[model samples]
Target: MTSSAPRRTVLAAALAAAAGAATPSAQAADAARTSEASAPAATPQAAARRSKSLVDYHSWTTTTDWHKGRAQGTGITHGARPGIHIVHPVGTLDYKDPHTGRTTTWDYAVWTSPAHSLKVPATEVIASWNAHTPPATWIAVELRGTYSDGGHTPWYVMGRWTAGDGASDIRRTSVDDQKDGRSSVSTDTFAIDAPAGGLRLTSYQLRLTLHRKPGTPLTPTVWRVGAMGSDLPDRFEVPASRPGQVGRELVVPRYSQEIHKGQYPEYDNGGEAWCSPTSSQMIIEYWGRKPTQQQLSWVNPDYADPQVCHAARHTFDYQYEGCGNWPFNAAYAATYRDLQGIVTRLTSLTDLEHLIHAGLPVITSQSFLKTELDGAGYGTAGHLMTVIGFTKNGDIVANDPASPDNAAVRRIYKRRQFENIWLRTKRYDAKGQVKSGSGGVCYLYFPAKPAPTQHRVLAELGIH
Candidate 1:
């Protein structure tokens, strides 16, 4: 387990455990609803895996490089004073065509990483980008992992990000890339190869390639490029749930994003895009803090939820084009004095249970239809909700921002249903049928240097 390949082995083991578990349908439901059976215990193997040695996390952004301008490329222009743009090219290329004609030339632009290194052994890799009014174009990312002896992995194609019609909306692409020759799409993690007498990973680099379609008036613009890796610890199993088990519910005031639905039509017209910010607002206020007047001053005075609006504006990723940017939301929480945050995945509600028991609330992501997740009464393409505590019968108590009003935000849902959706190891629909999205993403915010137990968990997960 000392080499880079160990990371993939760990993930494979988790997938194995997931595949082996027999998911009971109707019987499992009867048991949970009847308050009869406790959650199945984790097998010995899974427990051992959960206690494996911890890794570390690091990241680099557009600001990491020394050069502040755009990299060299054709049809490239300085994007909006400090950004990068790929303009449409007017000419065609005849060399590749055989029939009646020539193929149109494509505009290209790139951003290369500096010769930077990491102290800890790196694991998986992930990236996020922001752009405005992107045209029909393809984006390819290349990554390299270097060892102490200078041996490195090839410029592996991290993946391709593409946009067809929407120009200004932000799209958060997951680590699972549409591999185009350089890397395998089957695996999301990357390990630096340690050839015999070679080296261990010490440094890494990233490059972004933008492909703009020819003969279009619109250009593909980029605001920022962020890259990181699979640094979260692998904990495949969660502790069993017990009926009537409850934790001290941290009092987080709730605000309904629905209230701002039509107030700011520009900011994704508000509600659909305000969940992340509203959830952050609740967590920040729970810690006895509030956005300063200056932050809210720009908000329209007539808007009832000014702070929610403030959070949206503050956390919006200009290029990603929305308030749902995960890292951006967590970073916004860090801006409050005496607070620190990181985006990481938890094994299950058992992990959440541990945090809630220790007096911390967690923000988690899940998407479901109204039928799939009972009490919610509606479905979302994707949504963010805060885990406040568990009911005595092991049900979920949450501050669901999707409520129609602030007073209606607190909600309780069946334990099994809630955990299944919140975990995001896979996807589920409104009727509780499995669907497409993967889960395990969460946001954690607390005082700088959390308590020992909390710190140990975060440390093991390679989170801040």
Candidate 2:
């Protein structure tokens, strides 16, 4: 769902690889093991240092965070959860929604964050936000970055999003064909045109434009706006880590994408391509938030797990033509009352273990060949699954949606193999060519009011 190409096709064309990238083999695995054994023990400080160099995450979440940003026509709402809302009309614009093909006038206001320097000069950046958009309101998130060479990137639209799919709501989408000679946006991610040539985004600022029907009191309240910047090293394999949370597993719900196949073709050609939303739905429900029966009344009665169908429709990205827009799925989970979500990258399975031990199941993204992951039974260019827990032997316990039924969704995968596929930047495809890996991409959905331990852990991981 991340690309326009079919899921089974080789992803190397979309995610270009560096020259002379090595193929994955037994020798690569052995080398990774030797490197891990020869390395010093990873203390908390050492892990943080390593993670900071690979990925940097920044967000504006507090009242103080909102006040620091320059607001044209927006005001800060301070309370238990501080946010920004439209206060006065700054301007108006006419937007012809491509999906709806209707021109509508909307009152708009803008809030621009102060420039933030990334800890890691990044080769890629993906922005995410949490907001409550009423029936007639939606938000557009854009980012402008300064390159390492002192040049600037034009403002690129990260996403046009809303929580509703009502008649008046604009179809949530990611913009296409947005690129300069030095950089370009692929769906929700902003990528340097050629990172191997030493190009990196050093600093960036985000612009949040809140839109609503003209002359109405309705306004969208934005609680969080952030981006994950990463410069993961180009490697086909990464050092394996020993599991710390063996024999512990969170009981996450199981849902299969295959069961919902051909259910809603308009949303990414049916459930065959709904790995993101399907995996998202499992975690959303695991957190005890689900669509009410009334909310799901639109679904067909004949379909099993109507909520799965509901998720596919809600998370569809019209421009990308897929349901896998990272921020879109996060925003959709936030729509539920007292829930919040964000898209971020975890450094390793140790990070996943921390969340799982706190009773939080993580949704992860990765791509691999049929032979790469044991017991997977299939390969994918890109797919998402819920990592529920670790096995007694330190393997991964995942509720993979690419199964024949809900009961078959739970599978055990080798820890080393899964970690490499998830964390590596480069990987080999079925054709023995280099392709991109997800570099530990994941979605964290939890209660807006988290438990004390949950809050502490999330804060430690820089989520607040």
Candidate 3:
């Protein structure tokens, strides 16, 4: 379903012109030719919305290669990039002292991004990755930022992800404290708490480590590693999304949080607080995958929605003690068969529309008063929702997990109201220029096939 608007009409024209001027790749051309032959089309508006080349173009940069990053560690073999390779500790193996019966086992790998100074200091760093099977078996991330004066923040342990229970494990919070806005208990992401003036970091470096047990033959293959920067400002005014845009409203399966409420009290009573997992589940299923039977077997059989429980368990940050960690959710999605996920900041509703038109639904974060986001009927300091598509007039059509039941999951919000809450930025500065900050954080999932380019074109409107 779609609604028409003035802005969409203009976008329709622009896309048409682009389609004509460009020479698409063979795969993209075939998809476009096939769609045009089979699908009913009349107006330029409808044809623009149904184009495949547009989607393929953006899809090309969904995942990035980190091979250029430096790699260091024992039992490491290269595979495209750092942290992604075969690990076999064969030479000078860790040995046990017969006298004390103590052994020293060291097998690990590290991938560090190229050190680069920045003009605008970043307040937060988000690292995401995928490993074979048991996702975070033995992994940790450390980051450091150097100030213009040459002073540097000592390397901080963003998080140490080890699968089993151990005293040495130090992972970031997976959930946040709803009351005080602090991390719930785990630490997966790193944030530099600079003074009001902001930290002027001249250089930044991120390192990811993959470790293994001393004598085990088991080796985990790390797929890739990537990071993003965020600056959390003090003042953010939520806006209302007004009319005039049209895009496809995908039939993304709906799941209501209400059904799972009280099913698992420890996890904020299931649906009532599992918006992140629920949204994640919906998108994962939309991609034609679901939690395996073994994955959900841990849950009580009486629970109707076991997948939501499965998501919560895997996404739980032991250190954070919560399931809503932003990067963790994206990483969890990547655990599935073909789908790969990335955490990035989107700039505008226009960028979102492109993904939707490309047949991809986006998961987004927002904070707002009930009145600020009309039709939601509820307010939150923060929340996550799935942006499925747009209404004819350009309003947002979403699968809001906030609904009490699956039947009530789909919602259409006013464009400006939804955009304001979704992006969480100032409408304009004193000088009347758009604030242009990407408090508009989102999670993008794409297939492993047709791998994304080295430099991802994440934003359609170039706001970020």
Residue by residue across 294-346, what tens digits does model 1's lDDT show?
76777889888798887776665433356665655665675565565556556
lDDT of 2 by residue, 270-323 (tens): 888899999988877776678999989999999999988888888888887888
Each prediction's whole-model lDDT (CA): 0.55, 0.83, 0.56
Per-model C-alpha RMSD: 13.9, 7.5, 11.7
Weakest ten-residue segment in model 2 by summed lDDT? 20-29
* TM-score of each prediction: 0.56, 0.91, 0.71
* lDDT of model number 3: 0.56
Best by lDDT: 2
- On lDDT, who's better, 1 or 3? 3
Model 3 Cα lDDT, one tens digit per residue, 1-464: 00001111221232223223322334333433433343332346533432321111111111133545665642333433233543543333343423234454546656666775443455445556655434324665566667655676666655544333233222323322211121111244444333233344455676666655656555555665556654444335544434433656776878876688777666544557778888888888877778779767779999877898777766665544456666677777877775677776665576676566555678997756667778888866457789988888898899988887889999989888788766753333344433322367788765555222101223322211
CA lDDT for candidate 1: 0.55
